[model samples]
Target chain A: MVRWEPGAQERLAAAALELYASRGFEQTTAADVAQSVGLTERTFFRYFADKREVLFAGQDHFQQLFVANVAAAPPEASAMEAVSFALDAAAVFFPDERRPHSRLRQSIIDANPGLHERELLKLARLTEGMAAALRDRGVPEPQATLAAHTGVTVFGVAFRLWVGEHEERPLGAIEADVLRDLQALSPSVR
Target chain B: MVRWEPGAQERLAAAALELYASRGFEQTTAADVAQSVGLTERTFFRYFADKREVLFAGQDHFQQLFVANVAAAPPEASAMEAVSFALDAAAVFFPDERRPHSRLRQSIIDANPGLHERELLKLARLTEGMAAALRDRGVPEPQATLAAHTGVTVFGVAFRLWVGEHEERPLGAIEADVLRDLQALSPSVR
Candidate 1:
């Protein structure tokens, strides 16, 4: 339940992306982004550690949404379905208002090795968070971890599918495709 | 296959690990490693781009070996078992002479954030390589990728299992336990 000033953070991120697209990540500074966003440098620092952090602040929010969804998932849901429920919950958190900025953030992160590494670290953290959430709900060891990983892998594919084209699709659709992909891999199904 | 000066790379890795352990990675110079191994710094540079490169020089070699094993694996083997066969090949490749150095190498890579990130990148590359190899051998798209990832995930668990105090289990045994763990997570088994 970490509290964040989302408005300030979003403004800073938007400003940072503009600077990065025009200049570059290495050329842009937090002060420059803050100035562009009509905020003090201190305000920018309050939201993010540096320019790299701006691209990833949403990951923690997404992780929280994932855990909360998993915690409250229906008992009848399969392990993979529980994961889908979480992704659906996350889509609600990432509204249309944020998609353009998110796309820009992703682009910048993709171009930078340091940011890419942090993205991997964030994914690992989210997987661990999901595993912990599953464990709290009475799922056993290794399965809990493996299920969490399976969820991330599916999410990875679903996300790629979602972002592959500019048109938006419901998170549910993306998740369903991921489940289909997973089932298609099953020995009996294959 | 790319040719290597036989054991030259391994010798350099051993020398680098010893220096990194004693003097720390940041403090250790390439010249010091070469001096310890009674080789010229020129030879070391010819083998690796720089000092940091020494720690990761074997990653491509391991990936190639794993992919080749996957390609040669029995067609009838389950996806998990096919992955296990590749991992077993890796287990056999673990050098008896490099046990102490291997621990030190893992420690050095673990302690450094940059090194650890590169290691993850390497793992991601290997996962893709395995997927491509599987696909070439008639495995399909998502299944090929999933099988590769599942194998890599189990390898991670086995590596952790191998490192701790209760280290009597051979690598093969640890990998077997990992496979059992994965099957135990199956919907029917759970």
Candidate 2:
């Protein structure tokens, strides 16, 4: 049902990342990105609205994957549990070979204020999608919203750890540690 | 002691909000703000870095207030509990009279990408500050980070509820609901 072809978007994204990392995001041109993929500028436009869109081309698919996973979670799962399952589903989208490239994209986003805002908006949308999925699964209002917020916050922390070199743990291991961290944060204490 | 003079900051903030609401944030000049308060532009600058700073001016004080409260919590409280207590302290800072102004400020920030980016950075910093506070309170590495992240996410959800409601309830009630939502998130159900 998606209008954009997967390979075309992926090629454009990979090409954009190379151009952005090499020339800096501010210095990289649409023509440079198009030329890197041996595609015309008009063809690039067919995939993305502009240069910034190329950097975030796969976000829609990620949202779809997340929502679908949440929707398909076991019926007995709590709202938060369903969110955790959705996060695990999203992990398959990130591969080891692409980690460094994604890290570079995150770095460029961090450096650019406009991109950071867009990133925040993207995160907000993801949380909204998760909440909608939870609602569809019979979860109540505020709980659905809270679970979605918690899930995204967990993802944010996990991704930051993934990008940082802390004993070179695999991304899956780091994500598991993040989930454990959330579990260990109980209100009861000595 | 807090650094900024309270009354002066309050007047300038009120004037700026009024100008921003009526004339628009960009169209409203520093001179207009100063004139509204029957003060000089120099005095306005003394209170705020610029027109934009008027909207963000209280954030640092909020950080200080939150961290200090966390430090002051019972040493035996769990990391999340301590952070929750600190959030409660910060809740007192959100006076009933200020809700309208807070909503207006959010609208302005939402409409401007530059302001929204700064807002996200501020939220990130607050998360970091809460994490540091937890570490100081003897919480361990990753749990400290999770505690901070959860605290901020709870704050985020609570804020959205607080601002979205046209007829406002006490912030204490909203904070209680946010904490309950966090507690109701049972992980064992998955």
- The collision pairs in model 2 are none
**Candidate 2: tens digits of C-alpha lDDT, residues B77-144:** 88877987887886798878878878888888877777876787777678888899999988887788
Writing each residue's lDDT as its tens digit, candidate 1 over A1-190 gives 3445558877887788889878989899889999987888888888898778777777777778888899889987756557667777866776666666667777777788877767777776677788888887777766677778777776765665555547487555766666665554553211
lDDT of candidate 2 vs native?
0.79
Clashes of each: 0, 0
| Candidate 2 deviant stretches above 4 angstroms | A1-9, A39-46, A72-77, A95-97, A107-118, A136-138, A163-174, A188-190, B1-9, B22-31, B39-50, B71-77, B95-121, B135-140, B162-169
B151, model 2: CA deviation in Å?
0.9
Give a tens-digit lDDT track for model 1, residues B90-164.
Answer: 788764444555677888887887787677777767777888887887777667877887788777667666764
lDDT of each: 0.74, 0.79
Q: For residues A6-112, could you state the per-residue lDDT of candidate 2 as single tens digits?
A: 57767888889887877788998888888887777777888789999877767777778878999989999878778878888767777677678768888888888
Model 2 residue B59 CA deviation (Å) reads: 3.3
The best candidate in terms of lDDT: 2
Report how far off residue B160 is in candidate 1 (Å): 2.4
Alpha carbon deviation, residue A16, candidate 1 (Å): 2.9
